[model samples]
Target: MNINKQKMIRNVLEQHSNGFYMQTQFVILHNRFFAGTHVHVMLKINNHFLVEHFKYIKLLQMILILELIVFKIAKDLIQYLKIK
Candidate 1:
């Protein structure tokens, strides 16, 4: 994805995370399913928040595993990112 799209998506996630109801976390997680931008990439970015918050580690791990199974190619990349 180009920087603009990346920014747009990250903006969306950030908006949702920030409690702005303009979009939903489900939108990022679903990510147009096989269309538009890649869901794994957005989730990858979102993972940063999950990893940084120790209290949410288990949830973070769950998302990581889900991404691995669902996104296939992202498994190695996410594991390589220190999701542990």
Candidate 2:
């Protein structure tokens, strides 16, 4: 993510009632997901997961949808490699 976009997301997140907590959770989840970790497990570990808090947070929902798309592509690639 570019600096401006990062700033925008931070700004939006900071506007939430639980801004600091939400921001911290978002960063942690994002880092773990991009690091190739299982997002489901991370969410489970974090009890107060983002999904529950993200219902009204469109930006987060959009980001997660994109991440899911990337994850699907990666999974398909691995399956294809195994088939070869």
Candidate 3:
């Protein structure tokens, strides 16, 4: 993605990090399917109170992983199109 798109995404994540109420546990568990130990380590370290404090950082990490996966797929698709 371009810089503006990246900035917009970061802004959105930041805005929602506190009051955003979703099944965070489910998302964390699902993330294990993609990234294994790193997410596990992040979960292991944070206690209940610390989780609140660190929630934004955790969200950022998860989003970064997702963004990487998306960019990789986009890159592959572009290469395939060029070859065709």
Best model number under TM-score: 3
Off by over 4 Å in 3: 1-57
Q: Which ranges in model 2 have alpha carbons more than 4 Å from their true place? A: 1-3, 6-57
User: Which 10-residue window in model 3 sums to the lowest lDDT?
Assistant: 44-53
- Can you write out model 2's per-residue Cα lDDT over 1-84, one digit (the tens) per residue? 456655776565456423223424444234233334234312221233334222223466545543553445456657877999
**lDDT (Cα) of model 3:** 0.39
- For model 1, how does the per-residue alpha-carbon lDDT over 1-84 read when each residue is reduced to its tens digit? 355644665554444342322222322343343243324323233343222221222334434544443344345556877776
| Reference-based TM-score, model 2 | 0.35
Error of 1 at 66 (Å): 10
> Could you tell me how far off, in angstroms, the CA of residue 45 lies in candidate 1 after the best superposition?
9.4
Candidate that beats the other on TM-score, 1 or 3, i.e. the better one: 3
**Ranked candidates, highest lDDT first:** 2, 3, 1
**Per-residue CA lDDT of candidate 3, range 1-84, in tens?**
255644554565445444221312212322332333444211111111112112233545666544444445456657877999
Model 1 Cα displacement at 39 (Å)? 3.7
TM-score for candidate 3 = 0.36
